[model samples]
Target: MTTILVTGGTGTLGRLVTERLRADGHEVRVLSRHSRPYAVDLRAGGAGLDAALAGVETVVHCASTPRGGDEQAARNLLAAAGRAGVDHLVYISIVGVDRVPFGYYRAKFAVERLVEESGLGWTVLRATQFHDLVVTLFEGLSKPPVMAVPAGVADQPVEVGEVAERLAELALSAPAGRVPDMAGPEVRPLDSLARAFLRATGRRRPVLRVPLLGKAYRAFREGGHLAPERAVGKVGFEEYLARRFGPDGGR
Candidate 1:
């Protein structure tokens, strides 16, 4: 019954969130950089943004930049949403942004802080890296026969589909400030995940873990990226892989 605007609607997560909302009989409008039949970029602020948000009851913001440099734009989005009187703002963030030194994470953290201070009804869920991100990260980085990762790191990779469902559920509820974090069913070594990913893709590789020093590696190695008791996702690493590499993995 509500009209919601979904940022980054063309992306992996945004698409699923929009689909779920639509299925629930809610009106779904997606914002993106390139205008599509169902997309618009919310970054371009002004009356234009106000117009885009007109009559919108909720804004599920998933739009973000490549690994780094998008903090200001994120701020702009939040401000514009407030100006438009958006009822709820749901932001998807990464796990360990607090402890990690990664530039992208800093941006996520900044926006999360902004949302908290804005006094808007808001929910921010810090999630572990996506299982799909694992595959994407290692796709061309692995040296074919050798899987390489920053050494001593651990991660709990959850599925994007799971994230989508959670976002949909959160969109319908009052802002929980921050939702119970979500992650995969099991925790796995970074090297193991890389190896599993390569193997799932039918690629032969010996995964190599290269040591990295920094808050990023330190936090990751110290288990900054797992949500064991908070996992609400249904797909496990193996299950995700089967969808991508099992005999029927090829669609």
Candidate 2:
């Protein structure tokens, strides 16, 4: 059985990927900042990576730093992967990182470049935002009777499980540089998503649309993060909420 190392294995997508890989009978190693089995902090740059990379045929990088410093983490991992002579390196990134003008997206775009030029056989799969993230956004925006959201912001939120399965598939195959983007089955406006969440949670909050005034908002409005033509994922936002919160909505 080929051994695979999954960074950010404790995270939402990473956890699902690890489960899928193990279910397929591959020996999986989890890389994390916390002390655990096969843990390695990417921030330290190869301090504990050699042991994790040993006998590993592939590395799926799912860890990210949205606040900042993502490039350094990626570079550190790339260097270690090269030193280990790993055959394949797969990275999970957000869709529209190159087009979005946000700081986090810019950082991810840079990491994509690093992976491409790392001289190791590699594949990069960019997926739309996860459903769990949308829920978090809704929770954060909920402030009593009125919820304000940016106008024209839309998203194609895919299920974490689907994205994880795709990542696992790529890790098992030969490296294919920049594969087709994966996205949710449908694209919905930000306010619409919020409304769905409210309905699911049995909450009645009037969603107020606030005009967005930034390049990042404009890019999102223009469908930069959407992949309507390549909606490979089968789960939609409404379906996810129904399954997660139940049919009659939750308390």
Candidate 3:
């Protein structure tokens, strides 16, 4: 069995990836800021990172923060991986990092570059937004009496479990740089998704579409973040809601 290290191993996607790898008989190291044994902080130049990489053949980098510092974390990881002689480095990124002008997307794109030029065997998979993120967005939007959503914006929300499964598969295989994007089964409007959340939560609110200023908003409105052709994910938003909230809307 191969020895693999999964950064952010306690996170939503990382947790699943770690589980799959361990279940497949691979020795998995879970690295996080708070996780024991391998609790190294990547953002702080990843002290104690080299120890975690010892005998690790592969690495699945799932640790990222939308709040910032992702680029530094990636650089630290790449440096440590190179020093540890890691055979493969796998990264998960967003599909529209190139097309979208958002700050978080820009950081993700930067990390992608770092992985590519690190001189280590690497693979990168760009996926559409996860269902959990969409749910979080909707939960915040539904808080007010009138839910405000971006006008003409749509999201393709993929299942986190499916992404984790794919990452596990890639970790076991040879490094293939920049694979095809993974997207949800449908490209749905933001307002529609908000409505779905409202239905599932048994909440009634008027969904209002608001046109915001800036290039990033325009990019989103123009579908810069969608992957229509790569709609390979099996779970749709409605089905996800059904499973999460139950048939009776969890009422």
**TM-score for all models, in order of appearance:** 0.92, 0.97, 0.98
Which portions of model 1 miss their true places by more than 4 Å?
37-41, 67-69, 248-251
| Top-lDDT structure, candidate number | 3
lDDT of 2 by residue, 117-231 (tens): 9999999999999999999989889866799998888889999999999999999999999999999998889999999999998888899999878899889889998889988
**Predicted structure 1, TM vs. truth:** 0.92
Q: Candidate 2 — which pairs collide?
A: none
In model 2, what lDDT does residue 214 have?
A: 85
Q: Where does candidate 1 have its weakest 10-residue lDDT segment? A: 35-44
Q: Candidate 2: where are CA atoms >4 Å away?
A: none
After TM-score superposition, the amount by which residue 200's alpha carbon in candidate 1 deviates from its true location, in angstroms, is 1.5
lDDT of 1 by residue, 78-152 (tens): 788778889899999988788777777878888889889886899998888887888778887775566678888
Per-residue lDDT of candidate 3, residues 30-109 (tens digit): 99999999999999865589999988999999999999999999988999999999999999999999999999999999
- Quantify all predictions' global Cα lDDT against the true fold: 0.81, 0.91, 0.95
Candidates in descending TM-score order:
3, 2, 1
Candidate 3: segments with Cα more than 4 A from true spot: none
